[model samples]
Target chain A: MDNLFYAMIFIIFLTGFWIMLRQSNLIKKIIGMNIMESAIFLFLVAMGYVKEGSAPIATEANPGLAYVNPLPSALVLTGIVVSVSVTAFALGLTVRLYKHYGTMDVDEITRMRSEEL
Target chain B: MITAHIMPLTILLPLVGAYLILLVGSKHRSFARNFGLLTTGITFAMVCYITYLVSNQGKMAYYLGGWAPPLGIELRADPITAFLLLTFAGVSFFVLLFAYDILPGEINGKVITRYYALYLVLLGSLLGIVLSNDFFNIYVFLEISSIAAAALVAVNGDKLAMEASIKYLVMSTLGSGTVLMGIAGLYMVTGYLSLDFLAGALPQAYASHPLTVLMTLGMLTVGIAVKAALFPLHVWLPDAHGSAPTSSSAILSGLVVKVYIAVLLKLLYRVFPLDFLAALPLQGSLLVMATLGIFIGSIMAIRQRDIKKMLAYSTVAQIGYVFLGIGLFSEKAMLGAVYHVFSHAVMKSMLFLSAGLLIKYSGKRTIADLSGLGRVYPIPMIAFSVGALSMVGVPPLAGFMSKWYLGLGALEANQLLFLLVLLLSSLLNGFYYMPIVIGGFFKKETVEIRQEKIPLGAQISLLVLIAATFFFGLFSNIPISFLTPTVQGIFSAFGGGI
Candidate 1:
């Protein structure tokens, strides 16, 4: 089960990375980057999993206390929050880019900026 | 008198200052400037005092609210954190002063206050990263810094700024994610999240559980390399630093990149042992990447038309200096690496600011239009010359001091080949930097700049930095000794002697 989970994460991360590499559209590239980020988060959270463990928070004494480490969950929470913030900010920027250049393609933006230069 | 508030005060002062500026900041330029400058000025003083304490007292760790490590987040005041914090405060303070004229006109009304607010928060976050003792705390601070920095990059709200900010945001998030995964791996293996605990646990864990150790190290190293902009991982730096405002460029290139290097050093020396590192399959890959970055980044820099973008690419090469030092893994190399952290801040800040000033005062953004600029603006021209020469590793300058030490470190390691690479890159530096300086000064005045007026703050900062470059170059030993406590502390932490 653990191997299956790690394999899934690796596969998903690779797929996202693949999209980032192959995609021509700038927005799609950004989405692919975010996907890659999520995949890594998945791998991380998966690393902290136990076969039959429960949530880390404790209300009862020794309530089947085989729990996954709480630290990674805390870290992933921070990571997800930050990832969302950056995504929003990047999307804001993308909207502005579309307004200015009228294209969502990386190649076009490069050409336009180069020509301006 | 104050005991040891350097640990928390370094972070808290900036946070409070940022808030005060945000709250009280109106359209009043004088008001905003006063608050921002006062906050940063005090922080600079605090950093100097912190430096003295680090030199005198060795490593000092402070728990948050007096909570001890393993349970509470820790702030360690070893030489590395102190040195990095000093540069961050110093560079950001001067750059804040430099931005006095840029921010008001760059954005209007409340946005200027927002800019100052975000800038100070970024400063605070960087301080937190360098000083924090918990891996989770470091990740939180890294994210905060990255977001604030990206927002500031796009603050002026333009297409270039937007695109650059987005690219930086995406890549930086990826870096943070990778680092988070690494931290989780460590936590799962050792059941500890604090740096102090990890430092103790890592040795035994690495020996017993090789695969887990390898995976954790790989993730952490990749995450850090991504942040430090090491060669292939550096696709975002050029766009973000190049497209930001001049003051932001000064801060981003001059201070931010070095902080990543500092963090990477902390991770490598404090968290991972050299024995374990040597056991890795990709031991020399980092140095090889540094070499590639130096050659490729320099050549790429030479191909640029926009001056700031060129300087941004130059950073990719300069960062190679840090990695090269780390790769050699000698005290002399580490010393060179640490010293370059400061010198790079001073010299690169001056260079970027000069480029920005040239862009601002003269409206000449391209090299072709920079003809006869020196004749018109002699002071900035001379300053740029000193900076360019220093970067070219000319004598009696900070850049040369760093390169010299790095070369000595290489030779000390009996690595003559690395020494050759250093010399070759200095020559590459000449190829890239000299052309712009020579072209600016010696070329005929075809399209003369309309105005040559520069602000008093900008001019003073440039002169001070230029003099500082030469000062550190000539008096290398004193500055080096001050950093000795730091180098010794980190070296000792690794169970190795300096």
Candidate 2:
């Protein structure tokens, strides 16, 4: 069952990667990248899960119960921030690129740039 | 205890500088430049002191917020990290100096301060990448530097710059994602982010899950290969480096790309044990990729008409040399690779600065159009000639020393085929590099070109770098001593000593 969960997550990640690599539109590529990043975040958060686990926080009641690992959760928070910044920057660059080239397609941009050179 | 403080301080000083520049120097252009210089200058001094400490005290690791490795992030300063930090500070200072004069010509005053602020943040992030000892910390720093570097590439606001920046962003983001996934894989298996702890736990995990380990290595290598612009993965380099401002090109090529290589080295030797590496074909494949990078990078460089783009391709070839040294894996060869890192940093940055000077003064950027200005702008041309000679492995310059060491490494490893590749690449380097020198000095004037005086700061920076290239070549022992222990540290980590 655990192996099945890992497989599902990996398949989603690969789908995102395919879209990122295969897409011609810049916006689609960015969306694909976001999807890929989300898959990793899911994988990380899943790693911290414990069977029948409650919140990692401790209180007087049920202190002996299993608690999910919190370290990966903490780590993924940082990862999400990084992912957002990269997406923000990529979108900003896309805006400038569209402004200059009048196209949102990577193929058109490449063709136009090479022609200019 | 006092020495331990330097490890985190090296990263912190640059962070403080970036914030200061953004807040105080955002409105005033000159103030931004001065603040950036002062910050980098002080950081260089601190790096020198840290190098002194490492030489005396050996490896020093600092924990954040007074927490130990498992609970908090750790930053380690070994010989390699210290030397790399020092090189980063020195090269960045000079690149900033060069940019001071050249940026105004390429960009408008409105964005200049912001550009400096981004440059400071980029430098800080680079320092973070070198100093951090935790897996996740390296990923965070890598993203910061990648974003800042892409912004710097597009800061010129030209069409080409924007296009190049977008291409670079997409490729580098993929690289970062792979790296993050790889790190997550390691963390999930070992339950540790600290490199020291991971090293201890990895061998046991490796015995149980060899395929997982191999996949992690593959992901990390391919990710970093894209970031480092290794061979087939280098599509974004020429465009981004060529289209960016001169200073950005210099820093991006000279230091930014090499930082990834350094991180890869740290992982290869520190995080993964040598015996484990023996089961993998990483080194063998690296040799093939590097060979392609050498021959193909040079051949492509020969086809470029634009001077900066030509230099950009030459960088691809030069990176090929560093990887070749790594592929050899002999003690002497590894040393040569590390030395080449320092030599190439100084020489390449110097060449870019000189080329910037030529472009600024004469408005000529093609090899054919550079005629007669050599006689007029003798200082920059002479320095450019020094850089060209060094790249071609002319004696008494740094490039020659690295090539010689790489050759000796090939002989020691009994991979004589690489020796041939090294010689052929040098010849190819001469093919592309010498024509510019010859054209500049000997060829008759084809166009009406008037020489303008070189800026004071840029001139000083170029001469200093030229001197450094010579110094590193003639007295190669100084840096080799600094690098020997780094290699030894790796070897010792694997229960071997050089």
Candidate 3:
């Protein structure tokens, strides 16, 4: 069961990678990148899992209880912020490229750009 | 005592300056340029002091908030770190100085303030990358620098630059994701992010989970190779570096790419056990890739008509030399790799700056149209010639010293073929570079060119870089000696052989 979880994560990551590499549309490419990032984030979060752990918070009622590791969660939060910024930036560039080339297709954009040169 | 604070201050001052510029310079434009110059100037001073302290007193580390590692982040500065920091600080200061006069003309006037802000952010983050001794901190800084670098590429606001910027953004992000995953893998196994702690734990982790350790190494190497533009993975570099503004190209080619190499150096030597690395086929793969990158990058460069594009391709080849030094895995080769980092930073930035000036004055961007430019623009042309000759491994120049060390390193590692590759690449380097110099000086004018007075600031910057090229060559022993102990320390663990 544990190996299956890791395998699923790997498959999801590969799916995203394929989308990113094979996509022709700029917007689709951005989506693929986000998907790829999400897979990594999931992998990170899963790494900190304890089999029956509760929230990492401590209280007077439970002084020394097992809790999920908090570090990976913290790392995941930073990762999400970075992912968002990259998505926004990539989207901005897509918008600009669309305006200049009048197409969202990567191949079409390359064609038009090379002809211009 | 004072030097202990210099490490953090070196990073923070530019960051603070960047924010200050963003706040004030949005209203006042001239203030941005002046403040950017001042910020880099002070940062350079602090970096020099750090280098002094490291050379005399050995390595130093600064922990945040007085919290020790395994819990808190650590910023360590050994001799190699100090050397890289000096390279970054010195080149950036001079590049900014060159930009003072040239940048306003090249980039959009409306974004001048924002450009300075991004430039400082990039510098601060690069210094942070050099100083950070923890995995997570390095990742954060790596993302910041990558964003800043992509933004700098797009700041020109041209269609080509914008396209290149997007491609770079996407590809570099992919690289970063892989790097992050690799870090996570290492952490999952070792439960540590600090280099010292990781070093202690990785061997044990490898004992139990060998495949994970191997996968992490592969991922990290592949990821950094993409960012560093090592041959087959360098699809994004030429377009991005060729289309960016002058100073942006200088920084991207000269410093940004090198910092990733610095990170890889730390990962290979400090985090992983050398014996384990040697036991794998890591050395062979690295050498093969380096050799391929060297040859292909040069051949492509020779085919380029655009001057900037040609230089961009040349950078791809030069990077191979650094990787070659690393792959050789000998004491002298590693020293050569580190020294090449410094020499190439100086030489390439000087070449880019001079090329920028030539393009500006000549009103042309092709190698063919730059004939008779030598007489009209002696300073920039002369600077360009010196840089080109240095690239060709001309004796008594900085490039020669690096190639010499790298050649010696190849022999030390019993890799005679790579020594031949070194010599052949130098020849290929001349094939592309010599024509520009010869045509610029000896050939008659092809197109009538109007003369413009070169700015004193630009002149001063190029002269300083030219002097630096000679200084490093003449006193190559200084940096080589300074880096020897660090390189020796890394190799001593492996019994100094592959």
Predicted model with the maximum DockQ: 2
**Against the hidden reference, what TM-scores do the models get?**
0.93, 0.97, 0.98
Over the stretch B1-498, how does candidate 3's per-residue lDDT look in tens digits?
666677888899999999999999999999999999999999999999998998888888899888899989889888889999999999999999999988999999999999999999999999999999989899889999999999999987899999999999988988998899899999989999888888889889999999999999998988889889888899999999999999999999999999999999988888877778889899999999999999999999999999999999999999999999988988899988988998899999999999999898878999999988999999999999999999999988999999999999999999999999999999999999999999999998788787788888899999999999999999999988888877887888632110
lDDT of 2 by residue, B145-245 (tens): 99999999999788888888988998998898888888988988889988888888998988888788778888888999999999999999999998888
Off-target runs (Cα >4 Å) in candidate 3 are B494-498
Models sorted by DockQ, best on top: 2, 3, 1
Task: Flag the better candidate by DockQ, 1 or 2.
Answer: 2
RMSD of 3: 1.7
Task: Compute the lDDT of residue B241 as modeled in candidate 2.
Answer: 92
What's model 3's overall lDDT?
0.91
In model 2, residue pairs whose N, Cα or C atoms come closer than 3 Å (at least 3 residues apart or on different chains), thus clashing, are none
Clash pairs for candidate 1 = none
Best to worst by TM-score, what's the order?
A: 3, 2, 1
In order, the Cα lDDT scores of the candidates are: 0.81, 0.86, 0.91
